[model samples]
Target: MNAQREKLRMMLTSAIFAAIIGILAQVTIPLPLVPITGQTLAVGLAATILGSKYGALSALLYMLLGAVGVPVFSGMSGGMGIIVGPTGGFIVSFIISAFVIGWYIEATKATVTHAFIANVIGMFINLFMGTAWLKVAASLSWPEAFAAGFLPFLIGGVIKALLSAWLGIEIRKRLASARLLPYSSSKRTA
Candidate 1:
């Protein structure tokens, strides 16, 4: 009974985070190639707060929702067309970023410093994947792709990483204190 409840809780939390990501996706800066969106920050927060399993689940759920034409993506867009679009790599990389961030937090500690490190790493991963995808999808040269996809977002990415680290750590601490979050580590099988 307890295990079932826990599973349900985790799933619910993941769904909530997925919704949160979708909502944040609407907050966009509207860049040329790929608009700057709050999705990455949401992804960082989900990973920092929920840890590896649920964090990845949230990203996957968000992607799946958008892929199914749910308009859960940035600019209220959705469908398989978006998933295969120029910015799709960044969206796809969210799952990898969230999992890596959450796994790092679970393995180490969920402190702001650790979270920032993990978030930075995740940001780089996002930029790299997105840039590569942009190059191929848009048929641009490496320099052009970096200019449009990677370089433009570097400072913003750092800022978002810092914000996600600070806010996420604080929120996670509160959730843990309220007993809403599970263990800090991934050792809790139940």
Candidate 2:
């Protein structure tokens, strides 16, 4: 009974985090370049606290929701068109970024520095994928893509990484204390 309850709890946690990501996606700061959104920070938070697999699940669920025509994307947009659109790469990369961040956090000691490093790498991956797709989908030159998608967001990425790392570490501590995280569980059949 306890085992089943734990499993269900984890699933609910994943769903809650996915919903958080969806909600954060709507908090956009529109710009001429890539509009800033709270989505990445949410992704980082999920990954940092949940570790690789669950973190990826959260992000994947978010993308799936959007793909199925839910308005889970920035600016209250969604559907297949949004996924195939110019900035779709970044949206798609959230899964990869979360996975990478979670994997790193899981492998490491989960220190704040580790979270910061992992998140920084994830942000770079986002930038690369977003820029690459912007070039192809929009027929933009490399310079144009960089300017419009990557350059403008460099500072913001660093800020988000730092903030997410700090906040995620605190959240992880609280969740662990409440026996809500995977690592907080002492039993395993495997």
Candidate 3:
């Protein structure tokens, strides 16, 4: 009974995080090729708080929602069109980023420092994948892709990573202490 309850709780939490990612995705700053959004920050938070399995589940849920014309993507857009569009790589990278970030946290301590390091790695993953996709989808050269899809977001990525790290760790700590969330090791089992 207890195990079933825990599983349910985890699933519920992941769903909540997926909704959060959608909400944050709307907070966008438009650029020529790709816009900066809070979606990555929410991904970091989900990974740091939920660990790998649930974190990845949350990202997958978010992507599935957006893919199905749920208007859960940036600027309230969705559908398969966005999935095949130029920015699709970044969206796809979210699943990978959440998994990797959570895996790192699970392998190490869920401290702010570790979370920040993981988030930085995830940020790079997002940028690299997004840039490559933009190049192919937009039919641009490497320089153009980097200029439009990568360079403009570096500073913002760092800032979002820092924020996610600090906030995620803090929230995780509190939730764990309250028994609302499991701490580091328990998350592995959960």
Candidate 4:
């Protein structure tokens, strides 16, 4: 019964985080390749707080919502067409980012510094995916894609990483204080 309840709680948390990601998409800075959105922060936070499984699930749900015409995507665009569009790679990268960040957090026992590093790793994944997709879908050369798709977001990514790391630390502290997470023996010893 307790396990079932815990599972339900995790699911609810995941959905909430997914909704937050959607909300973040509404906050955007227009650019050439892909608009800057708060979605990255939400993605980082989701992974850092929920760990890989649930984190990926949340991002998947967010993508599904957009694919199904929920207007949860950036600029309020949605539907399956967007998933196959030029910027689709970055959109798809959200899942990968969540998985990478969450996995790193779990592997490193969720230290703040490690979480920041993990976020940077995740950002790189986003850049790679986004730029590659831009190259293929938009028929741009590597340099052009990199210039248009990745360059504009560099500083913003760093800022997001720092902010998300702080957010992750705060979330971890709250979850620990609330006794909401399963205690790790390794973490206890550390």
What does candidate 1 score on TM? Answer: 0.96
Clashes of each: 0, 0, 0, 0
Q: Report the poorest 10 consecutive residues by lDDT, candidate 4.
A: 181-190
For candidate 2, lDDT tens digit of each residue in 73-121?
Answer: 8988889888888889998999999999988877776778988999999
Sum up the clashes in candidate 1: 0
lDDT of 3 by residue, 1-190 (tens): 9777888999999999999999999999998779899999999999988888999999999999999999999999999989889999999999999999999988988888889999999999999998999899999999999998899989999999999989998888778877877543345322
Per-residue lDDT of model 4, residues 1-190, tens digit only: 9888878878898999999999999999988768999999999998888888888889999999999999999999999888898888988999999999988877876677888999999999999999999999999999999998899988999899888877876786678668775454114211
- Worst window of 10 by summed lDDT in candidate 3: 181-190
Tell me which of candidates 2 and 3 scores higher on lDDT: 3
Alpha-carbon local distance difference test for all models: 0.91, 0.85, 0.90, 0.86
Considering only N, C-alpha and C atoms within 3 Å, which residue pairs clash in candidate 3?
A: none
lDDT minimum window of 10 residues, candidate 2? 181-190
Q: What TM-score do all the candidates reach, one by one? A: 0.96, 0.93, 0.95, 0.94
Better of 1 and 2 by TM-score: 1
State residue 37's C-alpha deviation in candidate 4, in Å: 0.7
The digit string of per-residue lDDT tens for model 1 on 1-190 reads 9778878998999999999999999999998889999999999999988988899999999999999999999999999999899999999999999999999888787789999999999999999999999999999999999999999899999999999999989888887777777654433311
Q: What's the distance in Å from true for residue 143, model 1?
A: 0.7
